[model samples]
Target: MAVALDIVHDTQETYRKVLTSMSRPGTISTVIGDMDNPFPCHYATFLTILTLLDREVYFHVISDGENLSKVITDYTLAQETSIENADFIIVPNGTNEEAVIDAMQKCKVGTLEDPQNSSTWIIEQNMISVTGTITLTGPGIKHTTSLHLDITAELLEMRNRRVQEFPLGIDLIFTDPVSLACIPRTTKVSLDGGVI
Candidate 1:
């Protein structure tokens, strides 16, 4: 069984965690609640969307199974749109590399004057495995902080290219059942080895 999030309190906490996590890039923040989602995606991902989405924003979900796009639309009353037009893009872990790259390419990156208008990506992963190392630095880091992540080279390359435009890139939030982390556009990410 699953319990609905306490809209008022849980959202407030989740919002705080998101803010704190983004401010301290690479740090994991615990998500406060869960929902009864039959999808393979994480509950925290659903919770995050519930807390953030509104009828005014457009959202898109990329899932191999489950009609998450329809579910989110019905729940939030937010329009279910194409990735290119969505304000938020949600994807499950291990989505096809080509599809992920295509989505990344098509999504809005915002303009220099209105960078905050860019899309936010919610990537659902089961665990933060230590297959490879990445060093993050920028607004949140004291000097530089390192983390182990199981992300693909192609995905990282896309992010690298996007962030090259500076304030015109999309922001990302990685979530699991219990915790979440972020990689804001302003953060600098460097891979330890050649690629992973």
Candidate 2:
């Protein structure tokens, strides 16, 4: 039992580091956990699944394949659920704007009393940059900050729509090969819409 507790603690620590990295944007972080797989999912994704998933958590995989589902189930011991019922939604790549927005609409809002029960969406980006002209504001920002992303305009529109829900919409974590960025529902984003 002691060993099990230690493992859980370690997992939580790893996740905390990852979350901190994401919250800061353009930052790189490493995830040291118990994942033994050598293929497909990256270390960050593996750590995320290990930390956030369990028997009580339901995850939706939008990447399209049994391999992802198998990997998630084997690593996290989480149940597979549809978009409407998922507590966490993972998109291995961040290109599916329509699907992501549709899934977001289906996620539970958890009411005003328990907003933490709401769903979180994880999307993997090809790369993350700190040079884009877009600015972000809200809880995580001291004032406003700029970030560059390889995101589509359609996705930004969807995010804007989601932002209108304020504290009730799904939060986003965008991961790249070695870094991550988070845009919580509370964030207000403004895009330059310029060519990059």
Candidate 3:
């Protein structure tokens, strides 16, 4: 039991480092220390699963039986739930805009007192470029920053609608094979016509 506790502690630390890196765009962080599995789970996804997954947290893998989902379940010990009942949703690719939006709509909106119980969406981008002119402002950001996420227009529209709900919406984490970025519910993203 002592060893198990130590692994959990180490995982939590890695998760914290990843979150801090995401909060500050373009910043890089390494997820080191303990790992239960030897699969190719990226540092971002591994840390996310470690920090958020548990018996109480139900997760939905948007991709249809992707290898990433299997690895995630094996490492995190989180139960798979229907889209409507999930506490966390993972999108292995951002191309499925409709499915992603539907999953987001199904997430539960916790009461005003415990709004943090709401779901978190982790979207994997096929490509990430920081050269885009899109401006993001709100919450964790002091000033606007420029970054490009490889998400479809429909997904962006859905996210915009969801963000209009303020503190009652799902937060987002966008990651690639090597890097990751975050867009909390409080963030405001506006794209400039460039390929993102």
Please give the CA lDDT of all the candidate structures.
Answer: 0.80, 0.68, 0.67
| Candidate 3 residue-wise lDDT, 137-174, digit = tens | 76667776777776656677777776676677777777
lDDT of 1: 0.80
Instruction: Show the colliding residue pairs in model 2.
Output: none
Write down the lDDT that model 2 would get. Answer: 0.68
Off by over 4 Å in 1: 1-4, 33-40, 129-132, 193-196
Q: Which 10-residue window of candidate 2 scores lowest in summed lDDT? A: 1-10
Clashing residue pairs in candidate 3 are none
Clashes per candidate (backbone, < 3 Å): 0, 0, 0
- In candidate 2, stretches whose alpha carbon ends up further than 4 angstroms from where it belongs are 1-10, 19-37, 193-196
How close to the true structure is residue 57 of candidate 3, measured as C-alpha lDDT? 73
Better of 1 and 3 by lDDT: 1
Which candidate tops lDDT?
A: 1
